[model samples]
Target: MITIERVSQVPEDFLVDNPEGGAFYRAYGRAGIPDFELGCFIVKRASRPVTTAPFFIMKLPLNTMMPPGFLKTLLGRIALRVAFVGHPSADVGRIQGEQSAEVLELINSELRKLAPLVSYKGFDGSLGLAKFNKVIGLPVPVLNLPPDYWNRLKHKVRTDLKRKLKASAGLRLLETDGLPKEHLQRVYELYRQTCDNADIQFEQLNVAYFRESAPLSKYVLYFEGDLLIGFHQLLCSKQIMYCKYIGMDYGKSRQYKLYFALMLQAINICIRDGIRQIDFGVTSYAFKRHVGSEMHQTFNYFQHRNAWVNALLKRLSFLLEPDESELR
Candidate 1:
């Protein structure tokens, strides 16, 4: 037998207990985005007493001009489906063990009761989510650091890293708990520019998120004299260090190769700390691959509450989701 419990706020100890429940999700919950509610689904099974997954419920807006009638309700449903066509309520946790399928189905079944559609985003493909729906191959590049890390890299990569490090003579890399309010605002502007230029668009981060989550993780800031040219936010779990968020000034990026330099710095940090893997997040595949990173596939599994909508999604899944080519 299985039971499910939904709560508006997750307990503090829950995050501490689960390795998957990290600062990113906790910070996202505190971001206070309007119409978005953060909650967790607790699944209790006969074999395992408790399993929890955090999710974001995004409320769809109704058209004010629509009169209060059957037509309004009908249009509202359509609008909701369309608004969340590509994006569904996101589940941010991993399901492990032999009963993983049953556990995932239970969580999805519960989520379907509240939202018309639900998705588990960016999970490991090996977890058997493909049985429920079409599993897309969304791979993220990761670089594994061996004991003799620098020598393990290709000769070209090692040469470039050294050259970039030497060229970044005046640039000082500072590891701090957080940036000042003004510096965060500047970083936000740079982040906006980076997002605007991206081929893929997703959630936008606010300054509040940066401020609230600063103490939980390490921040690496690159300064060219007094000006902040770039910054990288890192989150560590066990042996892996996730490069969660990064932003760089375009003008300074080319001149200083700020992105590559920051990446090299992250590698050095990982090697020193004995962190095995550095997850370089999605996108910029070519550069990441060039630097001896191996790609690991991530999957997003989704289901719709409505049968007709679900059928439509099965046929047009490519159109509804992000194009894989866009990343390349």
Candidate 2:
């Protein structure tokens, strides 16, 4: 019997202890990091013990409309004994194991039934696995900036950095530790402005998120003074560092190449510390390419269950147009 349960938390040990499982689970679904709601399905047979698998779970703030009562009631009627709740992205669906022909078909059937009430999608291996004309992602590459690379930079890049350093006034580059409260507030302001310029609307992040992750993560940079002009966050393992989030005052400092300096600084730090790869995160941003970083494509997999909705989705997919002129 398979029982699905809504878990308040997906233990950290579970993710670290089961690398292959974690990778697999992340491929089909993500409960998301810290404080997001996640669900797991425990499968058991008459003789075998319980084994937890990533089934249908929600990340959060996305599928808030699907209440707990509705999910529980629906699951009870089916053979499924448990259900993970909430849409971390407002994307919901049923999750199964290493997707086989039969398993996908079965999932498709169940989704067909829930067609009217729910929509299903996921972050799968589709991106790395797909053969595309443009970009592809490998396992997050561990990178360190090569020594002397900075020396060979175009005269323009070097001049920009020098100019900024000279005029930085009271700008102090604080490491992840000892970052002051006022500093973060300014960084967040810069980040918000950047998002606005890009016409991207993001869930507002509270100071708590920055305060909590800043010191804990390996790289958190902030340029502080009258303005909180720059902020960057990096996530890392022993060998790999992900340039997770960054905010900067491009308008005020665009000509100064403050962002470039920040990126180079990250690379230098990584090299010094023996960190191998820097996953400058998603975005075909020109600066990322200028840093000699390659591009990787991440994809979303949407599977609609109902015949009507499935048909509806196919048409919608056809209508899907590239939102940007160049995906960088």
Candidate 3:
């Protein structure tokens, strides 16, 4: 028999045996967002711990991905209070240790008591539960750093990247363990711009998130003379470096190819620091792929407390995919 315990905070040593368990949620949750209430679920069988999965309570905007028009405008305001079995900002949904279909179902059952919309978001692996309204959320782009990583790309990609790198060579690169409050404020502004330009905005990470995440974050900041133009935030887990968030001056992007430059620089850092893989994130498939990022599929499995509402959600699930025409 399995039992689930929901709590606002996990025990300090809860992550000791299960290192991957509640850390991300705990780290990012410290500086909380208004609508997002992050929490943890402790699962046990016969008093022995099974695993710890992170969850959050929030009002999820159901029409977050719908195209801009009359219908999107109309339905966009319909936010549903949801209990999500995943982290608010992390790329992967980690239900660490012994996650079978039964475990997921039990957790789902427990979460539904909190809200009508209970979802399992951003899991790359199967939860093995067929009853949920399964949908393809977004595919993450990952670039692996193998030997001779730079030369392996297509000649034109390499040439264009090299030219862009050279043109932007005058820009100074500052690698910092953390950003000061002044820089953090500027970074937050750029982050808002990046999120605003995105087709689907899942979580609007607040400025407090930047301040709280600063200690754990490594920044690759770009400056042209004295002006800060672009900055990329990175978080390392074992040998994999996750390119978590980026803030850029888009007006200067066309001239400097800021995105491409940052990506190439990340590759250089990986080669230098012995990091194996760079998780580039879910959007910008074309650019990420142009630079040799492989597509890694991620999924979302959802269930509504009401049967009729569950069926309707499944039917309207096609709106979750990125609505990119040319795949930028």
Candidate 4:
């Protein structure tokens, strides 16, 4: 037997303790926006000493550009590929729960039934419980640096870094415990523009999000002669620095290279704090690869908890494979 429940139904303690669940909730909870479910999915097996997997929902739950039914079709496609999709490296810490073999089949079928409506690279149900018990396609560049080592970065990358440092000499990059009320709107505006330029619908954040996150995080922003041109946010785990959010003025891409410099700055901060690795987040950008960031596999897993659906997914796999495309 299998069981599913809304995220609210899950107890608070579990979400608090499980890092994966917490991250998922924070990212999709629209930064605490009201009326948005952000649609979290939890699965459990109803057998002896029943087991469960971490609560999961669509990775990019909001795609304003896509048609309303697109995600549903995508999710269905992912269900068909659950058995083959790899694990996500970005989500290192996951909530621990009982894994269900029976539920996998059920999920497969349900996904196929909804094929025309959702989209995903793979299903969290199938991939999460397998090798990593997590999604396996998030491309986070993890770096382990040696002591006093600015020597390891590629030469071109180093040269570019030098240029950025020289260009932004007048603008000081200081660690502020928090932003002033006046500066808050400016920062938020830049952030919103950055998201819009990329056609990404980021969860709208109020002043509280910035106020709360800035002090707790080691973030970097670039100001050119008193004008803020760039900003990036990062989270420091004991040995890992997770690159949370990034934004920069579009025109500065070539001249300033603020994004690349921001990453290097993060690395330098990591070295000072004794951080061993950096999780660059999901996408594989050119700069990430240029700096010798290793590509670790991550995956989405899914299982439809219905008998007929499972058989249908299996039968539809071949026909659906060509239609399958990555979420990014």
Task: Highest lDDT: give the candidate number.
Answer: 3
Per-residue CA lDDT of candidate 2, range 88-133, in tens? 3222122333444433333334433433322223233432211111
Candidate 1 deviant stretches above 4 angstroms? 14-23, 45-49, 59-93, 96-101, 126-131, 180-182, 320-324
Point to the candidate with the largest TM-score. 3
How far residue 275's Cα lies from its native spot in candidate 3, in Å, is 1.1
Q: What lDDT is reached at residue 255 by model 4? A: 73
lDDT of 3 at 248: 87
Model 2 Cα displacement at 242 (Å)? 1.2
Rank by TM-score (best first): 3, 1, 4, 2
For model 4, how does the per-residue alpha-carbon lDDT over 1-328 read when each residue is reduced to its tens digit? 5665434423344345333334434443334443223333356555332332233222333232233355645643332212221112224434335434455444333444433222233333343243222323334456666655567767877786677666656555755434555566667777776766653242455555665555445558787768777777776666667776777777764577666677778877878888777777654356666665676553433334454664564454333321123223
Q: Model 4, 203: alpha-carbon shift in Å?
A: 6.0
Instruction: In candidate 1, list every pair of residues with a backbone clash.
Output: none
Q: Give the clash count for each candidate.
A: 0, 19, 0, 48
Q: What lDDT, from 0 to 1, does candidate 1 have?
A: 0.66
CA deviation > 4 Å runs, candidate 2: 1-3, 17-170, 178-184, 219-226, 318-326
Residue 317's lDDT within candidate 2 is 45
RMSD (Å) of each candidate, 1 decimal: 6.8, 9.7, 2.4, 7.2
Better of 2 and 3 by lDDT: 3
